[model samples]
Target: MTKRQQLEMDRGQDGSDSVHPLHNVSSDRSLTVYPRGDGQLVVETETLGHLTPRRTHGTDEGRTDAKLPDRPSVHGLSPDLLVPQPATLEPLDQHIRSHTGYPDIIYQATLIPPANFAMVAPFVYRSSFPLKKNFPFLLKLGIKSILTLILEDYPVQNVKFLRENGIRLFQFGVPGNKEPFVDIPQDMIAAALATLLDRRNHPILIHCNKGKHRTGCLVGCLRRLQHWSLTAIFEEYRTFSAPKSRHMDQQFIELFNMAHVGPLIDTNHLPPWPTLL
Candidate 1:
């Protein structure tokens, strides 16, 4: 076929002359594909989206952009725990002896964090339900308490782990926010906020089924109490519970009576968060 005809066939009905990349070319990476045989020699280029970091909405326009830290503050936690330690294949005793003249004293293990884990404050963390595999990572965080928003009974394994580790469990047990009729309880959320505000509950982990809706609602309210703007609060809520965010939850946050939370907070035991209102 002639070059013009072949080019027309390649461009097809769209009529735009932009050439599609070769099958092997990735849109995200910088790679040049040299032509094979008599094929046209065209260099593949990365898209602008891949080269430049896309700024999140509301970051500009006079709104202060709150970015998540690369490493969140783990107050009172061992610095070593912040960075996961690599497991060594060498025998424990041999490795320990070689390093510090000790025998069988050091055991290296990989820490697997729970799904969707992220720090909400200095010592408060949010995530999906914890499992047996995530126990080591939780332990490393020095978590003293856990707050669960699901209405179901706690898992046996999780209960045992908390009992053995002396980690307190506070279950608020709110129903999921469903459409048409179901709604989250405002009082229960207020109570959970009181629990979160207590300094004694430092290093607490909050979770519900997927750590999205119910958990996001609770965190959204917490942000409100911290005096965050509605735009920032909604942005944070969507950050964790995107693609299926419940408008009901955002409405709940918007209309929530901070007065309910105020009476519940003990003046003497409040956390030292500077932003708390």
Candidate 2:
């Protein structure tokens, strides 16, 4: 096998960071993973790969020099969450704050209820594998009981785990075309929420690889559906994200450039990637 392919396989096993030319994200921050008082694991949001500081180092404790950092700082997406789903920006100690009274915006997946969050698209995203490989630390910090998930073309895997644990996995097939003008598949999104109505108070975590395109489009549509002023929603998602524009992943982006790409619920227009531009 190619050395690059071998390295990727290693990442899949250890879930640690490694130096790779194709990889695009390595956290400058540290990360800590621990069993939370609740069944969910508590992970340090600010640090990416470093384990949460502890007097003793073991399975849950952390170490440094990890190749896969949980999150690379990005715009609108909360590094604090580590998992990179949308939620209200409330704590100064965590991510920067933004407020929208709606409360439905923050969520894990559209298939689940947003815990006190209003659905806004600014936190949505989509990017290809080299980036996913770069952010290796993302694999940690979820309940095995909650099930891991996989999407149609989303490079990551784990849907089976999530479904087995009672986390619902929905499929909104992303078109294979690398074109920039991605139609927001409104029907799929609406149908997903219809399923979530039973769990109106539960939280959902929605993500598509980089959490930029597919996730963003869905969040944007959800915000619009809520009659939210897109402008305000953008402001809130930005406060939490670090923002990286442009990437080398796929082709077919010119159409994305033709459209007015505003922040999800809506704020200032962050420029599209060069391919999209």
* Residues 20-100, model 2: lDDT tens digits: 323322345444454332223454434444433322223433432222334454554444343423344345433333322
Give the runs in model 1 whose Cα sits over 4 Å from its true position: 1-107, 275-277
Worst 10 residues of 2 by lDDT: 141-150
In candidate 1, what residue range of length 10 has the lowest lDDT sum?
60-69
Clashes of each: 0, 65
Q: Which tens-of-lDDT digit does each residue in 1-277 have in candidate 1?
A: 6655665676675565543334223345565433322222324344654432222223322212223223354543322333323443365455435545443424557889988899999999999999999999999999999999999999999999999999999999999888888989899999999999998988999999899999999998898878899999999999889899888889988998888888888878788885455
CA shift of 16, model 1, Å = 72
TM-score of each: 0.63, 0.31
Q: Quote model 1's TM-score.
A: 0.63
The residue pairs that clash in candidate 1, if any, are none
